[model samples]
Target: MRVLMVSWEYPPVIVGGLGRHVHHLAIDLAGMGHEVTVITRRPSGTDSLTHPTTDERSDGVRVIAVAEDPHEFRFGTDMMSWTLAMGHSFVRAGLRVLAGDQETAWVPDVVHAHDWLVAHPAITLAEFFDVPLVATIHATEAGRHSGWVSGSTNRQVHSVEWWLANEADALITCSESMRDEVNRLFGPEEIQVIHNGIDVDTWPFAPRPQTAGPAELLFAGRLEYEKGVQDLLAALPRVRRTHPGTTLTIAGTGTQLDWLMETARKHKVTRSVRFVGALDHNALVAAMQRCAAIVLPSRYEPFGIVALEAAATGIPLVVSTAGGLGEAVDDGMSGFTFQPADVAGIATAIRKTLDDPAAAAVRARRARDRLTEDFSWREVAERTEGVYLAAKRRVRHAYGRPTIIERPLPERDPGK
Candidate 1:
């Protein structure tokens, strides 16, 4: 099958977990005897405008890059950056198609778009070609529980998300929890739940010597209010009271970093909490192995990939029962889930793990086994391919013939 995979970003240009997920899925699909052409925005750099770049045969996958507007790639607190990037991506993809390059002549049998950021272009292209479109909603606005956003931003994101689900042949989400959410919010749409997977080999398995008497708790990923980072900080004071030497390691940088740090100081827990800032994969995995257990205090998570990463490393996870985190963690088996925003609950869980290091080790082993058997990339790839095949079948039946789709053209050409 020929597949056109659309994502806003890719490796060497990751904005979030979604980029890494897309990169792996494409590679695995190609390995399974499917031809995959990834369409993504070129990273901002000197090579941003050198026409189409091809990543030929890496892990048996072929990737095609179509450069997008560099200005829209700015990263910050503005949520609109993603929406604007999607708009430009559509224009750039359209231009590439019109250029009539033989290198990209094989139009996709099915279009798989990841997240709301690239849904606009994916929907337009699928409609233009009358092909089946499948959208993977990594997260949702309602899940974030954010207060009202700008009218334009809200409407734009909501419209694209809704249209993608309504127009696409089927919808894909990372967990059964997300499947239920999409169904409840978007009416009865065909939704498939594909849990996120990790490369076990990539994440080293040997357990590092646990942090001494003062247990170190690690939290990695974006630092945002919705992520419950502030709530975790609030829990630290109590955690320290029980385990006097407990040290919390907070990694990653975000809009809420200053406030989070200030809150730690206000509670005089700054000495107990170490703000490690953002870390590369090597450092992150090392931290994960060394920590007693990984804590994810997300208000709502679609699928706690970080939990899977920790579990893959033979480390127990304490995650919020909010959203899909519950599904990823098996309470008392591999890890435990607590109610969202309960600082006391988080602290208590930490203390329990610290109380019996041996018991905690048993749980960590269980978590690692679960990840190895169920969530490896090979298994994930096979399941994802099932969705791609289903989408391909849907497109074939709907169009009755092969249909070639391209992104929408811009109203005005800036290059001119």
Candidate 2:
């Protein structure tokens, strides 16, 4: 199957997990002998053109980077303008591919759009080509803001998300929890749950020394309010009371860094909490190897890929019972789960793992086993391919011998 993937984030311009997810999915799909073409926003400061630039990877994936507006984004309107500009570029790129401008160009059988950022373009291209649009909602605006679209920006984003779900032929989410949320919020006719996977071999598995100095707890993700980093800081004092030598290491940066430091000072656990801004893959693997356990205390996690990474590294894991984090780990069997924003519960779970090395090791082993057996990129790609096939079948039945209409590409407003 030939697939066209639309996303706002990609390598060298990644904001979060969504970019990494798309990168892996596209490459893996191409490796599976499926023709995959990815259309994403080009990184700023590069050669910015009004047209899209194409790059072919050794793994057989073709990436088309759509140049975005060069204007500074100061307000919500500017951001929307940029998104619309990207959509316009995507439409133009699709038209070129359909017209066979290049020797290797071929029309995509399925248009797979990731998240809401590229929803506008994905919907437009799918409709223009009269093909199936498969949308993957990585996270929802309402979920990120704790079940509320507080501001105009959030409301608009939520509305776009609703429209994308309504427009797509098939909806795909990263977890069962997300599938349920999409059903409740958007009421999509059908939704498929595909677990986000990780490359288990990428992380080295080495047991910490039996006689390590202090039990190091690691939190590796954005230090944001919804990520519950502050809650983890609050739980540190309690964790220290049980195991005084225990220390916490945070690996990531976000708007809440200063506030998190301030929270640590207020809790009088500043000395024990080390804010390590961000670590690359190798450094992160070292950090994980050094740490006794990994904690992800998210208030709302669509799918906790970090938990899976920790599990793959054979590290004891503790995550909040929020959204997909709970589904990622089996409470007590593979890892521990605490209530969202529950400081005591978070501390207790951490302390339990620290207090019992044997039990913690057992849980870690179980998690590693599960990661190898279930959560792999190959498995994820296979499952995703199934969705694409189903969507193709639906499109074939609904629009038998559909005709493509060559319409003029919509004009983009850079100053909207």
Task: Specify the highest-TM-score model's number.
Answer: 2
The stretch of ten residues in a row with the least summed lDDT in candidate 2 is 407-416
Off-target runs (Cα >4 Å) in candidate 2 are 45-52, 74-77, 97-105, 392-416
Candidate 1 clash pair list: none
Q: Which stretches of candidate 1 lie over 4 Å from their true place?
A: 44-57, 70-82, 94-104, 146-152, 208-212, 392-416
Give TM per candidate: 0.87, 0.90
Q: Which lDDT value does model 2 have at 107?
A: 73
Question: Over the full model, what C-alpha lDDT does candidate 2 score relative to the true structure?
Answer: 0.82
Evaluated against the true structure, the overall lDDT of model 1 is 0.74
Please report, in order, the local distance difference test score of every candidate based on alpha carbons: 0.74, 0.82
Tens-digit lDDT track of model 1 for 349-415: 7777778777888888888888888887778788878887776434332322211122232232111
